[model samples]
Target: MMDILIHWIREVDTDIRLGRPPLAGEARSESLAVPMMLQCVTHELLTLDPSLGARYRDIQEWSVQKALSHVQVRRMH
Candidate 1:
């Protein structure tokens, strides 16, 4: 389950990097919405399984930071 969630998160990160729309059913208020979405997903996952929260902390942090950087760059352009 952890592996699956990690893989899905990576895919979402890639979609964000490519400037693609949110995965089919995902709701987004703006184009650069991955960071917020990722944060929410991370929080929910931790809530679901507190034991694995620590294991995913680094990934959640990195992905959110990366998405934020992308948003900043886009805004500057």
Candidate 2:
């Protein structure tokens, strides 16, 4: 199920990038929540079984990068 969800996430991202209308409950624009949730799922999987870390390493890294892309410089008032 995780593999299917991961694949679907990429598909939704592509659809948004290509300007296609989002289906029900799908994001219409880039969202920080997407990668954040993916990262959380990856973390939980690794926590459940450390041995799975190797398999999810790439996914973990990709999620981290995607989350980081949402960061922006902030100015103090």
Candidate 3:
């Protein structure tokens, strides 16, 4: 179920935010995959039901921000 997966992802995100250990064998550092996956899932759900966009707007923003945090701005010469 997508709901179950979202719940689990949110739980792990919360744990990571609080500096707590993730599930056994899971990486502690922030992984680009985490937010990317959430964004992908959210996009798919929104595509299925347009009305759900309102409910997931916050998630969309949050995932976008999370994913952006991985970007590095470089000054190349």
The Cα error of candidate 2 at residue 76, in Å, is 12
Candidate 1: Cα lDDT at 3: 64
Question: Where does candidate 1 clash, by residue pair?
Answer: none
Which residue runs does candidate 2 get wrong by more than 4 Å? 15-20, 23-28, 74-77
Which regions in candidate 3 have their CA more than 4 angstroms from the true location? 1-3, 11-27, 75-77
lDDT by residue for model 1 (1-77), tens: 75665675566445544345566877644334655666777788889889978787887887677667655343554
lDDT string, candidate 3, 1-77, tens digits? 76666666677456434345557887557667877888898899889898998888987897899889889999999
TM-score of structure candidate 2: 0.72
At residue 68, give the lDDT of candidate 2: 87
CA lDDT of each prediction against the hidden true structure: 0.64, 0.76, 0.76
Query: What is candidate 2's CA lDDT for residue 39?
Result: 87
Q: Give the CA lDDT, 0 to 100, for residue 64 in model 1.
A: 70
Instruction: Give the lowest summed-lDDT range of ten residues in model 3.
Output: 12-21
TM-score order of candidates, best first? 2, 3, 1
